[model samples]
Target: MGGINLNGLFIKPPSSLLAEAYDALDPNGNITIKWDIISWTPDGYVAVVTMFNFQQYRHISAPGWTLSWTWAKKEVIWTMMGGQATDQGDCSRYKTSPPHCCKKTPSIVDLLPGTPYNQQIANCCKGGVINSWAQEPNNYGSSFQLSVGAAGTTNKTVKPPKNFTLLAPGPGYTCGPAVVGHPSKFISQDGRRVTQAMMTWNVTCTYSQFLAQKTPTCCVSLSSFYNETIVPCPTCTCGCQNNDTHPGSCVNPRSPYLASVVNGPGKNSLTPLVQCTKHMCPIRVHWHVKLNYKEYWRVKVTITNFNYRMNYSQWNLVVQHPNFDNLTQIFSFNYKPLTPYTSINDTAMLWGVKFYNDFLNQAGPMGNVQSELLFRKDKSTFTFEKGWAFPRRVYFNGDNCVMPPPEAYPHLPNAGSRLKFSIFIFFMTSLTLFFLFE
Candidate 1:
């Protein structure tokens, strides 16, 4: 867009003609009223405009003082009202006073970039008498039309969206929800909820051609904050002991990790069995991973059925190795499960199940479970230079570890158990059928 009049368009109304009301008209209905742009700084621009009023029969100042050229399209419509004639009965024709209050006012607006702009003036009054006044011969009224100015272009920066937040457990929380695959949290008071979030864009563009106008735009930013809530501290009240929801023998009756007892261990009469008959069954300690967007997993394991011999001599923990199939013994008196279960090391040992062995066995005098020969893959097979008795904890392969494929029926109960009895009856019936057929 080019600049308007170099010397600036200035208008000095003739003193002889008093400021009076005039109605402007044009074929296009209401004409747009605007002052030509006089001048402007490199940074800012100014525009002048006036509107004709019917009641006073003269022009008046329009509400929006700073006329914006972009808004001109919607503001140009005008109207005119004519007054009654002396004859009283509807005077359809011209009368002594101009009945058309806005009749003489021109409604069209035209902007010129350079040549001095001109305006035509005409008077409209109550009685219908139209008085035409002098204007530059080629033009219309007593209005001073000035050229329109161009608005300066600005380079705006698009702002990004606010960070996404997981609302529960409140903000600034670093701990994540348990269970890697589960949804982390529900919506909280502050509106933070789901961890996953995304951003969408909107743009305004003209459908048609060259020289067409387009809307300015910006970019959006997206982010998220993850918070974790510890599964409501598992209720210790009911005395549920197993993390896996096992049946009988409440192992680790106080731990939140143990789901529940699936079953109990052997009942031996020899040992003073302080059988926690209904317990949080010991989990074959395995790693439970919590994953965020990042790759690294926070691994944790909870060992149930930690038999701390009342004699304070033996400390035994049945743990499910990280790889899943292996069942291993962690400690036994001469060996204590990773650091004698001090308040501090208890948490560390649980989470370090999957880390390097040297560090894991560093539990000092507490690292037992070093007996039993490896029937299959043995930890000792790997170099354990840092002075460890057993290469890796070992267990009875035939008894401790036998993972049936997913489709296989789980272990059957002992003989005379419900399943065994059912099987016995079935075989007997088959034999009887064979005899009958014979």
Candidate 2:
């Protein structure tokens, strides 16, 4: 009979025992769970399970459990411990061992009779589990508890979605609704709540909009003291003399002494006729380049009236360059009308400047006009040692100036020429000796 009884107990499946345990749980009773703050720090704290019970059942499997707390009336803290078997202890190190045999704290057997179980929860919060809890102890004082069972049992009270208010105008001039990627946040006046939203500035300029030809206006502050009030939009143009009467208009007709030289005939071949006429080639342009900064250069161009007999009434000069990544301010002296134009052509940048003067007083016989141009280039593509090969074209009154050729080096005789000269000398000597002998 004793042998039969032992055999019967051994033959009973483990599943039946598990079923019995599940049925013993009271469906109407709450699964009571208790938490205790074991250790605390300024950043966070270490918490443990002091006691937990489900009817009289000591072993219970509660997976997808969560602990939550209200923080600072702004943030809701949640700590999740994924699916775990309480009979074997939630500790990963002793997961295969029975709860009573688990050395780690928070063992199921340790908390079976409402006894406190000490163990550190892993990945509880942002700055480590313990540090995260200690970060705001004052906030944790309000509502800090643990829920055992499925994830649904945890507090999931949804708060109102945050809204956004424009603090001030962004780098862009206009503002609109928030965007997805760009997030911004601001605190309330009482500092109790924080408003967060994905904000984006309005489109300031687009590819098609910039390509369109229109008057460009810049936002300028009216008063230096306060950055408010959009100043009147002024039309921008490239030219000298920006007055109310001649706004955005360059002075035309550069010079008055723009006439060709003429030769007068002598009167009756006896009295010589003196004639003073303007020459077509009155101005001579001299280009001077000097390294200013890293890859920047100061190009000083001097226009001199080399002709001592004629004066230039109007003149126009155009200078070009290879690259103009950043063109500095242009400085011109003795020239009234000047305009700088920059355009992108293919892969290179084309920069042109027209220097003109309507009055002849600025340029007279033996007079000179000077202007300085500053520009930057790619260091790898441009260097002072390689020499400035730019100003691909320079036009003086529609005529391109001919660039002077580089200086030539002295010629030297090679080995082949020396051998040929030696052979000729040998033949000449042999002929002279034969004549002498004869």
Candidate with the greatest lDDT versus the true structure: 2
Off by over 4 Å in 2: 1-281, 333-366, 406-438
The clash tally of candidate 2 reads 15
Q: List the global CA lDDT of all models.
A: 0.22, 0.29
How well is each residue in 68-144 modelled by candidate 1, as lDDT tens digits? 11121111111111111112223244344522112221222222223222322121121111111111111212122
Note each model's CA RMSD in angstroms: 36.2, 35.2
The parts of candidate 1 lying over 4 Å away from their true place are: 1-286, 306-438
How many residue pairs in model 1 have overlapping backbones?
69
Clashes of each: 69, 15
TM-score of each: 0.15, 0.25
lDDT for 387 in candidate 2 is: 26
